[model samples]
Target: MTRSVYVTGIGRSDGRQVVELGVMELLTRQVDRVGVFRPLVHDEPDELYDLLRSRYRLTQPASSVFGMGYEEAAALQAEQGTDELISRLVDRYHQVSDAYEAVLVLGTDFADTGLPAELALNARLANEFGAAVLPVVAARDQAPEAVVAEVRNAHDAYASLGADLIAMVANRVADPEAAAAVRGLAERLPEPVFVLPEEPALAAPTVAQVKEATAAKILLGDHAGLSRDVRNLVFGGAHLPVFLPALTEGCLVVTPGDRSDLLIGALAAHSAGSPAIAGVLLTLDERPDDQTLALAARLAPGTPVLVVPEGSMPTADALLSLEGKLTAATPRKAEIALGLFETHVDAAQLSAQLSVERSERVTPMMFEHELVERSRAARRHIVLPEGTEERVLRAAEVLLRRNICDLTLLGDPAVIRKRAAELSIGLDLPAGDETPADPLSGPGGATARIVDPQTSPLRERFAEVYAALRAHKGVTYELAHDVVSDVSYFGTLMVNEGLADGMVSGAVHSTAATVRPAFEIIRTRPDASIVSSVFFMCLADRVLVYGDCAVVPDPGAEQLADIAIQSATTAARFGVEPRVAMLSYSTGTSGSGADVDKVRRATELVRERRPDLLTEGPIQYDAAVEPSVAATKLPGSAVAGQATVLVFPDLNTGNNTYKAVQRSAGAIAVGPVLQGLRKPVNDLSRGALVQDIVNTVAITAVQAQDAFPHGSGG
Candidate 1:
């Protein structure tokens, strides 16, 4: 079997080529027959892959390595579907995988935007290829906590999806803080995590890179000067003495072509061994006199002097935007990257893991990947009650890794730390800050804090608030104080207080335990008379929304209609087209019974309330899902077989059907997601796996995004 790794990033301009080169180094060392694959690319050729081919002497043809352009893939997806797009890419991947002992798959980098969609597509491609996911997190000058958080979340996301596990790397970390970041990640992450400090030499853009960016004319230059890493740019708008002082080593000097004085002064300084500058860029498409140019060249032999048509400001913009590339031309950068990777990572352990079965076993992919992508689009914060539970810890790692949303885990700080260390979760144990920084502001990466309800400063305040809210029931502050100490209550209070946008509980707790606090504190949205729950049934080909599965018991016709409306909205919000099926034992008017009548009436109510929705009711399960069954039983009905939202008559029917599909069909059921809440709060099954917790947490974050668009959760 071919051992493969998918190298990708969650954000744009992540500077992941270093990790890609490092992995290529690892793969070539492990096996002589190494192949490279890039699933999607922009219009231009990939510089890094070209470098790999030249350097590694790989025999695999470009046709095998390059799948298709992003535009081509998008066109295919529009014409066909994502399934067809992935199918072709998977076939392309196997061509390389079958021919090589080891393969390295590079992800896409578009000429433009759409990062969230691209990241999700990359993840799906990784899964369809059955490759172990290796995500490179860029931590360029971000806080130490953010760096570790990003790595952990990335690991968590892929790991929860049941992708073959590989270690994570936090690359391009600021050098001064890298050691501290490494030490902090020693205990929290559940997987092997490595930190690569930023290398200035590698980050410095070369004269060639600047020229490419500015489209300048190289008036006079040699290979050495052009290849020199440009560390800083010095605008020569000052006198000779003033500019001489600013002429630091590796600085790119930008001046008017006529500024022979500034040019000669800079090169004279370099000649006097004040460290060689990265050559001078002449602006306004002008050049010095031949005599002065000759003098400048002699002062620093073979110095690059380029001229651009743009003014100082435009040239400055180009220089500032340029970053060094690790192409075949820059073997030094490749060496530096490999050194960093080898220094921080255990290559032997990685090799052993690469030999695992993840490369050959492709699992079904849909809900989990899309769930995460949607939540990240508009970030929100969610609190988890069972902080010390292994499943919750793992789920938190993935959520924070993607910086999916901010998270607060309610539990004892020490226990959470110990448990996280035991599980090897890469958390760095986010400090018990009273409140986390805003995740929506930038990609700083989200984090989770372990707040012990017993000692939380907000506990008493929450108790008093709860007492006042429930005082009509004769609840006292003393009684509320005891209840608020429970993790579930504490987390819900966090949501109610706008401390967290939403809450996800019940990995170790019960559904009643999770939702009871929400029912009491979070309450119902003003538009809703009652709260309901829906399960997103992620079948192999599509997602089906199942409603009233875990909330209302035996709801009347009105409540059933409300569930249908809520479920349809939830389905639409999550990208599923809302074709509602009011489920019962009977189909249409084929049968006459009380249950069927209730469904028919509920469906009618749904149509009345949400006149825009496509709803059909009193439909059997087979007719609602299988097109063949729908055609025979309820012919010409638009929603008979195309239903994306299924509203059961009551909790018994919804809950049992969801579980049966979850167990028997091997579908991923993400929910019991509560709808019509003033704020977002959700529950998990006690038997929920790590992936289930991950899915539910993502759903909660997305819901929170909807609820708290204005503030934290207020």
Candidate 2:
């Protein structure tokens, strides 16, 4: 996607320089198409554009998605009709958009204060063509809130007219705190926040941010979260001077321990107010000695301290995790520290993972539980908890009245009504017929005849078998026998046919009771292997993916390999790069036997199968980390340790292991988020937390998007 902005008047040359520089930086990061447009240029096309075009070999005539060749654009003024002028601008926008993924419509400086009208036209055009509009607000030393307010007003105006504003890019941010405050203020607004830190383009931390994001807290001192303008410095043993000056405020420093001079220089620069001191983290694993402590005390006093035992913390593999991230915020500060931590989190790493723009693709499918949300338009049976509390019953009542889902209860309708009335909780399930029917057949009605075995769609699909069954004189009875093994038999039938998209049961049944019918009838996806589960491990920095907690037995090396690959693929779909580690009781080559061998062999197989994947195996939790240990054991393996996606050899290890990690390590498990399904189908724990329900729905939607990439989830 590419966006090009047009400008007729920059208050001054410096203003023009700032505007062009900021615009180019933001656009280059976000889009592939970069061009400029000026419909009625009274003067030379902005000098900055010329400089950029000349420097970058960009084409000229300044043709943009909105074609405003200076000659014809100048005639628009002499043209009598306003509608005609607007129509031409709109047509040009369409032409430009066709050639690009997106177009940034820049308003012109119509000398007669026609800038607003031009902007309105641009907004209308953007709305018509579905372009993301991000108004660029240029300011210098202004109140943070004022800049935010102006951008928000413009955003609201566009949104009110049926357009979505992606974000606002502030030009010439001078104060670090004010810029941070501006970002903070804008996030509170309905729109997303994108801040351009004040720094030279050559010194931006784009690469470092990418590394931080991909590594998922593997590296420290990458504070791209606070500053958009962070540039890496090329240095050897002695170029600390150049590096120190270029270190903008809030920039993260990632240097080797042997490069003590650079570290000291960074600390000295921060001491001198060169920029904001985000945090300083040592990358090596050797415990801090007197010298290291002294240096850290002098340079990073009170700053959050983190040590990544990943030996040398510069690898291309670690940087790929940032493939789709839009901002310079490092994964540590943005996602891990701030996004994960509700309050004050580790400041040292917060810059790397500070929350920024997430994936923009909207999911096409709803969760199994969310089916009730569509009840208003269709008649359906929804299963609720058998012994639901008053609050839950009341909520169900509201849902029923709103047509969210057709209410279905397993208990007697009369008893349910009496209870609901007694507790002041209303419900519609109580009004339905309470009479029990035959298990094999459905509700008695004309619909029953439509479900005849010979004339049914199932008959056509299973014709030979049906004929043979008829010959046997009792085969249909046998097929119908498996229909209702429990009280929720009718609900299972909805899932069998496509009458209902899915069913949510198990609030009152055991896991076996809830899943047996599904396994017998609904069945597993055709391509799926053994069913498996993964918990949505919500950690401080990013979400952790744990698997096989609910299914699978002692998976062989191949099964383990498949689990790793499937988990990694799922993580990628969710915008997370997988660093898979096939965990065993042993670390390195210390232990032998089927278990360790399985991990070792599986790790190799995963690498061979998916050359693009990052993985390691037979690694102890500590050795996979603790850089000192990793360096000693696996001298030079790419994914020697510090793995993110942990694949256990069997369900026993996967289940028990994740539970221990949660209880002992204080990690919150968001799922047993099921994986390897054809659709976004998830099984709920009997005692599910409310947040779990919400997250499952979100995951279901995400999976639905994956299942139906073309928006055909329904």
Candidate 3:
């Protein structure tokens, strides 16, 4: 509740020294000294305690923070059973709290400190000592969210024990989204959340990455900024045979005749403006062509272009020999491009499918029996707006027929029937045609009267509110009439009142037109700080998640974190634990700024808040999938080495990055998977196909499962 809070008890491992230091530095201002209580201390020298003593400036017994000064007693005591271990741990906390202001409880390397008991002891101690309680979640090679969840669970246990939760610290947040998600969760929590970003490991070669995938020499024009690992092979048109050796070794950019202006221009544009090219190869058949040489010099003043004797087919063949070296591994540029392609083609295919047209593209998550079972248990409900588009009608029918969702169609029964008939479909009417009840008439109409009846204390409250609503300028009788008459809005009301599950619209209206009413009437989820969108990408070989694809503009770290959690959870619903990678211009600590800082801060927050999620970031798209690149940039980061979900920094980055990946990577982008809604509702593009509708419906069904387990619509 306060701007800042104190933290105390924490267990530490050998490598956790930096973690301890970073945490203490961040929290030192919030409270005086943090009681460092741990289950065990192993192989730690007296100097470690000396450092801790100096940092907190403790004058009391060294055991106050070090728990017996790293002696054999500490090691032997740490191996004891949970109950005894916790009993001593709690006893130590009370003794320390007499001097310190707050207790920052630490968990073990894994959740192995008998978490439940430790939390329980902390709670009892907090009550006895009258000190605020903070839980520091530390993990080794675990997902950020998972760790956060464990911390939260422990915190919950402490809270149940009657201890006040001051804040939570997530140690070793490795990704941008993971951090953001933790931060976001923290922002929404009753207490503050802190995440500690992982430090970079070592710089690995971009050239090595390119060379391992493709047998092409790294050719630089006049500019030479590419990584050193990229091999350089001078190009000469006449010496085709010589270029052959270079071709089999690495990535090669063949320029026009060595003295040509075109080659220089291409090199300058590519090397200076984009993904660093490995090297440049220039063709040279004749010695002195003054004009061509001058042009080359002007275009690529600093690039090192390899010169080789020229002959078209032979030169091309020399380059062809390197084909065997080129693997299918995707580069960052290629990955980003492919994501775009997948999104466009997939969205188009889905759009057509929703309209009943045959489509080649299948949604990432097909409506299989297992998924359906989940849906049945979850009981997702979907709403069809009034006067249904031909596609919406068909989609609803298919969903009901397929048992994918509890379908609700808003509009007059007769009108809907009429429309259904026009579309060659049958339907069961909910009401007779001539009822003509004014849904907006408040307590005057039969429907209003039906709602106004003797509930309890809120009956008059509802009546008054309805009357006042009608008086409000925006709540025009016409608009109110439409809301009551429109089945989609009406169905949304059902969801709001616990009668239905989810609502979908936008086929016959704009996104704003459909969402405005929901935002105004239904409200956001209880813990949700903001609303955002995600795109589920199913590539030929893998599934990727991209977010803020349809919502949020300049999201701060907190907002990005929310988007990451929402996206990760959505991905999990589709059967992926969602190793989320927070994307940025630079990988690891290669860059800096508020944007980079925000991502770093968010990653820290998410690690502290969710801890259960695997995430790493400030990573390039390439680093998300390429284990080799990840090894270089993030080293031991679990997510950076192999990420499945990617949270972009902002809308531009998210949208453009997704589009680029889909388009160039040949991936299928399945959704603008909306999150934080009450039910499994989704939007349809104006030009959506029938398959798109079916797929969207399927996704909604899954969401329904997530929202309401056991098919409870309410």
Which candidate tops lDDT?
Answer: 1
Which prediction has the highest TM-score against the true structure?
Answer: 1
Candidate 3 regions off by >4 Å? 1-370, 412-415, 426-479, 482-488, 663-666
lDDT value for model 3: 0.52
Q: Model 1 segments beyond 4 Å from truth?
A: 1-366, 430-444
Using Cα atoms with residue i matched to residue i, what is each candidate's TM-score against the true structure?
Answer: 0.54, 0.40, 0.43
The lDDT of model 1 is 0.78
Q: Model 1, residue 609: what's the lDDT?
A: 90
Q: Is candidate 1 or candidate 3 better by lDDT?
A: 1
| Candidate 1 residue-wise lDDT, 1-714, digit = tens | 777899887776677887887787666544556789998877786799888987665567888888888778878888898889889999989989888877899977634633336767777888888788888777887876777677778777767666665777777777557657765785676667767777666788778889888999887878756766788889998888777888766788999988888888888877665646778999999978889988887877767889999999988877787888889886555645654565566766776767733222111233454576577677787888898887787677666655577777777776776555333344556334333332222112565666778877788899999999899999999999998999889888888888888889888888889888888888999889789989888765457888989889999999889889988899888767889999998898899888889999998998989899999889998999889999999999999987888888888887888989999987878888899999888888889977688788888888887776765562
What order do candidates take by lDDT, descending?
A: 1, 3, 2
- Winner by TM-score between candidate 3 and candidate 2: 3
The lDDT for every candidate, in the order shown, is: 0.78, 0.48, 0.52
Rate residue 17 of model 1 by lDDT: 86
Superposition-based RMSD of candidate 1 using all C-alpha atoms, in angstroms: 23.2
Q: Candidate 2, residues 1-714: lDDT per residue as tens digits?
A: 343343222222113233333344334333344455433344433543454554333443455523454445536645655556657766766666566532334445434433335556556656554555555555556777766665566666666776556555455567776677767776577655555443233223343343444342422232322223233322223477666666654444555445666666766665554543444434554345567657755664443333445554353234322222222222211211111111112222221222223223211111211322222223333343342443334434333333333333444444555444333232323233442121112111101101222223443343343334344555454565443323444444434543333444444466566555455445666755656667756443345567667777888878778888888876666545577777788877789998788889988988899989988778876665456777877767566545556677888877887778777875556556556654334555666643344344345445544454543212
Better of 1 and 2 by lDDT: 1
